[model samples]
Target: MLDIYEFSAVFPSGTEIYSQNVQHTIRSNRRTLGGSLFFDKLLAQLHVKSVSESRPPSANRGYLYPPSKDGNLEELHDKIVSAEIADHYKQSLLYYLLKDCTALDDEEAAETFAKKSHLSHKYWIVIQGLWNLDHLQFEAALEYLTHPSLLPAFPEDILRVLIDHGKLANKHLPLAYYNAVRPPLTNPDLQKSYVTYLAHLSLIQAYFFIETQPVQDHKSLFELLIDDALQHSRSDGSSNVVDELINLPLTAEQEAWFEEYLLEGKGRTYHAARDTVVARRLALGKYAEAIEAGQQLSGRRFNDINWDGIKDMVATSLGSRVEVDSVFNVAEI
Candidate 1:
């Protein structure tokens, strides 16, 4: 099995990949990798089933079955060899399946088999990365996982693992990995997690990232991005998250969505959120609605309101709207 020391020795800049305090952090979070979904995915890809009533009971069968610790390397090896799996996949499968084996020879056999099958070095990197991830060795995992030679397999899972297991200091590592790999984030859960992380980094960054996403996802994620800003603003008055959000120069559709989100959606929960709705309406020349929303804000955080910021937004909004309307009017003419 590839250890952190081996990884650091192999890579030229491995020693500098993480901070000096990371060893203490990793020790505090140490646990078995068997608990991760990555481990289950490895088993799932091999089509390893669990004990069931329909299947007859046998020692070999029980050993091959998941969530059952009653098997050994010999039985697992025999089962893998007999199965109809493709040859290329079999080597990696053997490596992982034999990883937890206590016997020293079994672990060596896995490495030897991988070599015999001529598994690509990148594949070995993936294995080591995932192995480190499993053991909560985050820094080492990042070093291996972010290697240029490997394809982005289980990208969403990799992110989830990093976010789920990593400490606060290691927060930037996930973003680093995301920037390096640029994984396609289609899963909503992964999207939320990544967005939350982005929000933690910067509200402006989050807004820009959300802007780049598919249109259909804009509403929920935009809503989430606002919610994050609101919460951060509420907690830390000097955070500037809200300040950044209001002055974002949102498109017409986004402006409408923002107004609706603040007025009717999760934004309603935060203090002074309606003030933004009022400022936006005033910016876009909706006097009646602006007055209406503004009236509701009276006696609530009156002195705390950012009238200057609102005025600035209105000035920028009027100019932008006039330009857009002028272009449309010319087309109509």
Candidate 2:
């Protein structure tokens, strides 16, 4: 049995013409052309003709036939056909067709596709493309970055690269995307160690760009650092106090309190707090303070305090011990 479908085709003149299509064969029946294929071919021919006639008079226009549009139409038809054969084939064909579409870099393309396609799929494609771009195109990157669907998939490497390139104009991108995605830190120690590194990069970028001070999301940042310290802290070993404190934006009162705490008893204050404060200063490479603190901590009264043990922990935490000797008298402190 034949099925007929009808719709109105609108013209540039603001007039609509009613049209009907007849399907003459079933899926099981042999056919010259499937109903959908026939309609797709007709549409393609009409679109190509329309585009060809719209070009302005120019020498290059002769060679600029609408073949590109026709090719895309054919690709779309093949994708639809492949989708019916297998689920995997459908995904593959769709990915291939949409993967390299430079048109998607345009605003109209983003808007149209966002409205018509499954947003999740479009977001994945755009994010993948952005990751694959060697030199990021800011506009294209922004298109995907701003897409609500894409934010959750933004990769950490891309975020790092963006910060390195000095393009993270808005601090909120990292704040928002990290909160949403929260990529697992593979190496907890390494990740914890780099908090200051990332923060310093962000600070430098902020200074260079003259951007506003980052909103001090101190609660979250400090929580992360505290967790890191607790995770890596050994009861017998010196604490990685510097890693915990350096990234923290201390208030004047807090800084003053630390200063007083470290300097209280004719330098005996630092000796008493050596295990805690020296461990921290060493983590931050505050070598001079570490030497002074270590000397006081290593005095005859505190000889059993294990100065070598403390130094070894600091070296391991910092990934190098070369500067440890310069900071303290190895024989005495």
Winner by lDDT:
1
Task: Output the lDDT of residue 196, model 1.
Answer: 84
Per-candidate TM equals: 0.67, 0.30
Global Cα lDDT for candidate 2: 0.39
* Candidate 1: residue 163 lDDT (0-100): 67
TM-score of 2: 0.30
What's model 1's lDDT at 84?
72
**How accurate locally is residue 172 in candidate 2, as Cα lDDT from 0 to 100?**
44
* Cα lDDT tens digits for candidate 1, 1-333: 332122222122311222225323323333232233354466566775423444564532432333232223334445555567775555565555434331223345446645655766777777777766765678888898889988887887787777665635487888888888888888888888899888888887888898878889988998898888777777777546776777787888888889888888777777768877775566567755665565454334422654544433444655554533332221210
Q: How many residue pairs clash in each candidate?
A: 0, 1
Count of backbone collisions in candidate 1: 0
The clash number for model 2 is 1
Runs of candidate 2 exceeding 4 Å displacement: 1-135, 138-151, 163-176, 187-196, 201-333
Candidate 2 residues 1-333, lDDT tens each?
A: 100010011001222111111011111111221122212232343332212334442422321221244333343434344332443333322332333333333224333333344345654555444523332343345445545555333355444544433144553444444444555544444243335334443432222221221334333333343333333343334333434444444556544444454455222233334455565566557756765666545432222445676667666755667776556445534
Stretches off by above 4 angstroms in model 1 are: 1-35, 49-71, 97-117, 167-169, 236-238, 278-292, 302-333
Model 1, position 72, has a per-residue lDDT of: 32
